[model samples]
Target: MTVPPADNPARFLGRADAYAAARPGYPAALGAWLEEAGLLSGGVADIGAGTGLFTALLLRAGARVAAVEPNPEMRAHLEASLDGAVRAGQLSVHAGTSEATGLPGGSAGLITAAQAAHWFDPARTVPEFRRVLRPGGRVLLVWNDWRAAQTPFNRAYGEVVRAHTGDDPLRVRVLEDELPQHLPGGFERHTFTHDHPLTREGLRALATSVSYLPNQGDPAYPAMARGLDAAFDAHERGGQVALAYQTQAFLGCLD
Candidate 1:
């Protein structure tokens, strides 16, 4: 599918590619968990699909997918990755945000937000999700959070990000409050943790992908980079760093 240039005034446009490369994808365990819970059937909506990371997994699991993403660059990456599958109509893309998905009401059997729910306005997004989903449809909001404080090297890296970006971890802060009230009755929560090894380059890319990071030419950018390098040097073993994540998944069924 041909995509237009990113026109959204959001800061994510510039870092979309970095995000695609650096960010971890949802765990295979999540797919199993969803299947065991009987939530992986009919059609699924990948809210904030972002480069098709989680979207690819949904496709691999034999789920029909509707990708809703507002950023054109990310959408383009998704289209490029899916290529012929998209042409054959196995996947579809919509230029929309979480709060306004632009899909038909009662069309989706499952909805998922992977690592991008924090950017959503829950007040609007929750209702919109309810509209798109069929009765008994499930919503899964998930994030892969680096366990920065558990290790010295990770903590040091976290400090650098805090000092430079002034933003907390990428996990959505509203899930705790919104999930209880925003979701209709019959809600449940699940969590699955996993680890992935990262090289110095991967760590740097992960840090720089944040929306708040300064670009290459900016003076603060170097400071941010240097800080990240120091953290990696401190804990890197065998030319790689062990990055651990507390991957969390929250699931709820819309009444």
Candidate 2:
């Protein structure tokens, strides 16, 4: 997968709704892992916190969360989604990127980028993350990757995406290969299986939510939608299909 240009907010423009609605939240086991590892002992910073998906998880785990996101549309959705938490003083939304989080130095015990690390320029963001984290603080990178080989529908869907997008650097699996160079101190890896049940419409939204995929106006979009429909029809039972995912977490600290 080829990496897209950094700071390309246009990729996500106008797609915040689909992204918020279709994206799978992290598994509860992630919170349990954080607790066990002592990463949540203080405030947390969730960088690239699109639509508050992972931010909600951090808040639910009783941590004061600062959700740093650069895209206005995505950030609006995040703020709206976590309005209750904001009013209660549990979560704060910031207009910032991974490289420039606007967080005070050494203020966070843990910094996380859930499904967003690929957008960052590690040269800058890694050092910035280290700056914001207190001593012994951890950085957790997470993704809910499609288990493409798990079922016929999953395999077909994978083919469709690759056919249209060519090489999608945003694919979660690529992170595992690239992260080590950025965090050379090494990371502790963990994986858990999760499934999201989706209706045909929900499946379509999920397909389009990916940033690298062709959008509605693209010449290939109709075929993309058709592929997703076919996958849904083949796998769906009782009006829903189970989309399998391998939720991966990589935990480490800067030297």
Worst 10 residues of 1 by lDDT: 1-10
The runs of at least 3 residues in candidate 1 whose Cα sits more than 4 Å from the true structure, single-residue gaps closed, are: 1-9, 166-172
Listed per candidate, the RMSD to the true structure in angstroms reads: 4.4, 1.8
- Assess every candidate by TM-score: 0.88, 0.93
Model 1 pairs in collision: none
Model 1 scores a C-alpha lDDT of 0.76
Q: Which has the greatest TM-score? A: 2
Cα lDDT computed for each candidate against the true fold: 0.76, 0.81
Please state the error at residue 43 of candidate 2 in Å.
0.8
Q: Using alpha carbons, what is the TM-score of model 2?
A: 0.93
Q: What are the per-residue Cα lDDT tens digits for candidate 2 across 12-62?
A: 887888889888888898887777766787899999898888988888788
Tens-digit per-residue lDDT, 1-255, candidate 1: 111123332667677777778877778888877766667776899998988988987887777899998888989989998976698888999999887889999888999988776676566777898899898788887777775326666577678867875644433344465666445655667777767677888887777676667756668988888887888888889998877777777777656
What lDDT, from 0 to 1, does candidate 2 have? Answer: 0.81
